[model samples]
Target: MIHHHPDSNMMLEYASGSLNWAHSLVVSAHIQLCPKCAAQMKLLNGIGGTLLAASEPVTAAPTPADSFERLMARIEEDTDASPAAQQVGERQTTAARTRSRKAKRDPIFASVPPVVEKLLSTNPVLPWRRLSKGLKEARLTTGQNRHEVAFHRIAPGSKVAEHDHRGKEITMVLYGSFSDAEGVYSTGDFLVREPGEVHRPTATQNQECLCLSVVEAPVALTGFWGKLINPFLSIRPS
Candidate 1:
């Protein structure tokens, strides 16, 4: 069960389409695993629809037939200009999407939502950087954005390095559970850590924990060793 969730304001942004793509991707994944949030999202969507219906409609836009013709003409022009190129592009896309290793058979990862599955289609699961004992990280890309997104996997009963965020960091528990100063975040829990807040997360002993994390800036370590290497961690915001 999820014990934590994004605040009302963030959810409002997500429902209204104001959140950035990177954070939106993680939030969407959390909403998939969390029925409570999913229900709330449905309500929010309905409210948005109601508001839109009450507003004045755009009467100056092109007609459906005109838009359809223009869209079809553009597609035909592109296809005619590079049929072979389009075919090759489609093939490459198919291969990339099918490249997921454990997403199909592995129970731990099989439940990944489509938003995250798309990223894994190209990122792969290997080559994880063993940042610390029993902890590994694999960065995922959601275009060139201000936020840095990644998957953090922690072995059972292992504790992560104590650290504080330089900017807001949102984490969604994808599998298993992890506990920090605030509380234990089980599967589907979405929690936010603000700048200067300190916490050390430790995975539950039953199973390993996998979390999707989105950080606006690099984290600063609170421990001695963390202090030494903190200088090397930096985010070049785009």
Candidate 2:
């Protein structure tokens, strides 16, 4: 069973198509992996449609075409879509949201969710960039300037250096389990860290840990090497 998940507000935003693409990808992957979250998404989608149907639309003189098109597009979704089919399409909208053109920029490159594989494939093949002894990252150019997104893999029994966030950081485990000072997160777990929050995460000795991360800003690593690296750690351009 999954132990952590995005909050209700985050789920609502994702359901309503208002969430940013970067974070939405994390949530999208989580929903695909967790049946419980996927079910919640269906519920939220229904509630959103009902509320939207009952509410009045803004008829401002300069109503944006894209906004109006989105509203009409959502309103046009077949009310009778099958549960099985809807389940399959859960991540499709997310894939669409991430469709913007980027200005720039495995084994665990295998076995990830299809959406993840699809998005990462759009960029050139990149060698896994080692961040520390046991931690390696594969970056993704998700069109946002502030959010730096990537997949991180930790070798079994390895510990990521302790660190605090400069801005918000959200992590979703895709495989195996890892424990932080807060708790142990397993597959499908969603974690969020706010500015100044600190923790050290260690991959369980039993298996390698792989995760997807979306950071609003770079992290402020906590020790000697971390401090040395912090000044140079800036969000990469999308």
Q: Which candidate leads in lDDT?
A: 1
lDDT per residue, candidate 1, 39-73, as tens digits? 99999999999999999987665543343345335
Tens digits of per-residue lDDT for model 2 on 1-238? Answer: 7989999999987887777667777888889888888999999989888998999996654323334334333433422234555765765664454343222223553546655655565544654799899999878764446577887899999999899898889999988889988999998899989999999999999899989898888888898888678888887745
Candidate 1: lDDT over CA atoms?
A: 0.77
Question: Least lDDT summed over 10 consecutive residues: which range in candidate 1?
Answer: 63-72
TM-scores, in order shown? 0.78, 0.77
Top candidate when judged by TM-score against the true structure: 1
* CA lDDT for candidate 2: 0.76
lDDT score, candidate 2, position 219: 84
